[model samples]
Target: MPEKNSSSQLIEPEDALLEAFWTRAKNVAKINPLEVIVGLDSVSALRPSAYSLGDSSEEADRLCKLVMDGTKRATSSWVASYQAEDAPLPEVGELSIICDGSGTPHVLARTRKVTTVAFQEAGPEIAMAEGEGTFAQWKAEHDAFFRRECEELGIAFDPDGQVLTEYFEVLYSH
Candidate 1:
């Protein structure tokens, strides 16, 4: 596990690996045309970019593995810093690779839905969706997490601030 300064970091896929994977995918495409999804040849073609999931390496690795295992299906973040980072908001039906905190690609995921709600709105429904724990736990943990994040970024944490939530499905495991 490693520590990171950012929630998500983009990775530039290796061309050699991409070409090899494409060749194999192409062969499979011939057999299961429907199974072969397009725009998978190179990771860059997957979406606006491939990214990691958490601010710290250890947490990112844990979360990424959880997502790959289908144990976690949703995640949320403060919209302000996300906007400040200029990262693209997840959109429904977009495919992107998930990398570890160390910036190594680990799995691919397709966004199923996107939601925006205030911090105060983080409740049982979203907590259940996150699969992290109970709503109370989610709220307390998220409040602390966001506060630390705000302190680091020199920003204020507003309980009413919008939080971006994304629900996704694992597309490929590696």
Candidate 2:
């Protein structure tokens, strides 16, 4: 007659194998989206630029570093989130860098207005418009810069023809 294997009399070796398997399975389990966002935000805070002095002479460099670090952190978190589930995609956003007339760099959450006189002292005028011509030119340049930065960061923009202007408006309204 074959011997019966009862739970109470389970062998130590078999119990160890079962425990190890469970541990591995739990490690591979998906994390919640909210949890992923929290993780991303935490990671973002740990980045060097995230803590840099905004008024320092190296503000521009720091801003660039912040954007790069933030994007990388967010992307990593996003990938982890995606692996954990098959619904509710993470929202994507743009990073914009604009320079004033004095060549001082300002990081915009998205594309927005900056005065014309801000960039004029930097060099010759590039474009002309009424009311916010200088601001418009600054925006145009910032948009180009933002696109380049996104490319460098390897993050894809929205595919539905959303432009920086719309992005700025959304950001500003909020």
Candidate 3:
């Protein structure tokens, strides 16, 4: 006779509906930071800079156009919110983009407590710190909560996991 395994639990129908709703909402609100960088670079370069001259001028223009086009593509492909209110909520940390000498972008999420004095000196700093912290925590909590909810709903939680470990390692190494 074959040995029987007895640790499986059945999912409930009501839990399934809630999990589906949460997944959809979470999926709809994700932002691609690469698109933001592209957009900013594209928009910023069109304005003449003090260093624009000779051969460098042509290169600058080319870079600007490339960035703009790339950003446009990224923006269109990913759901991005430009609105201030729609931006990630405020918390206590930030996600920074780390670029190599070649200008390749990588995300580095970090947490730090801010002093009230620093906030007073720079109004925008406070908002930035909050947004970064909130976004990081939200992503973590959402993943755990969603996974548990899915399990309750009898749904497998594997959704093409993108490995953020490599990026974090690169960030910490620096």
Off by over 4 Å in 1: 1-48
C-alpha lDDT score of every prediction, in listed order: 0.68, 0.29, 0.27
Each model's backbone clash number: 1, 2, 3
Residue 57 Cα positional deviation in candidate 3, in Å, after optimal superposition: 14
Against the true structure, candidate 2 has what lDDT? Answer: 0.29
Q: If both were scored by lDDT, which would come out higher, candidate 1 or candidate 2?
A: 1
Ranking 1 against 3 by TM-score, winner:
1
Per-residue lDDT value at 147 in model 3: 58
Clashing pairs in 1: 2-57
Off by over 4 Å in 3: 1-85, 93-96, 100-103, 114-174
TM-score, candidate 3, is 0.18
Query: Candidate 2 lDDT, tens digit per residue, 104-134?
Result: 2323233233322222232222222111235
The parts of candidate 2 lying over 4 Å away from their true place are 1-133, 157-174
Report the lDDT tens digits of candidate 3 across residue range 1-174.
Answer: 111232122112233433343333223423333554778433212211111101222333432233223321100000011121243322233333222222222222222332322111323333232232344453454356445544545555543432111111111211
lDDT of 1 by residue, 76-165 (tens): 888887776676777887666676666666665667999998898766888887777799988998888888777777888888998888
TM for every model, in the order presented, reads: 0.72, 0.21, 0.18
lDDT of prediction 3: 0.27
Error of 3 at 59 (Å): 16
lDDT of 2 at 15: 33
Candidate ordering by TM-score (highest first): 1, 2, 3
- Model 3, residue pairs in steric clash: 90-130, 91-130, 93-133
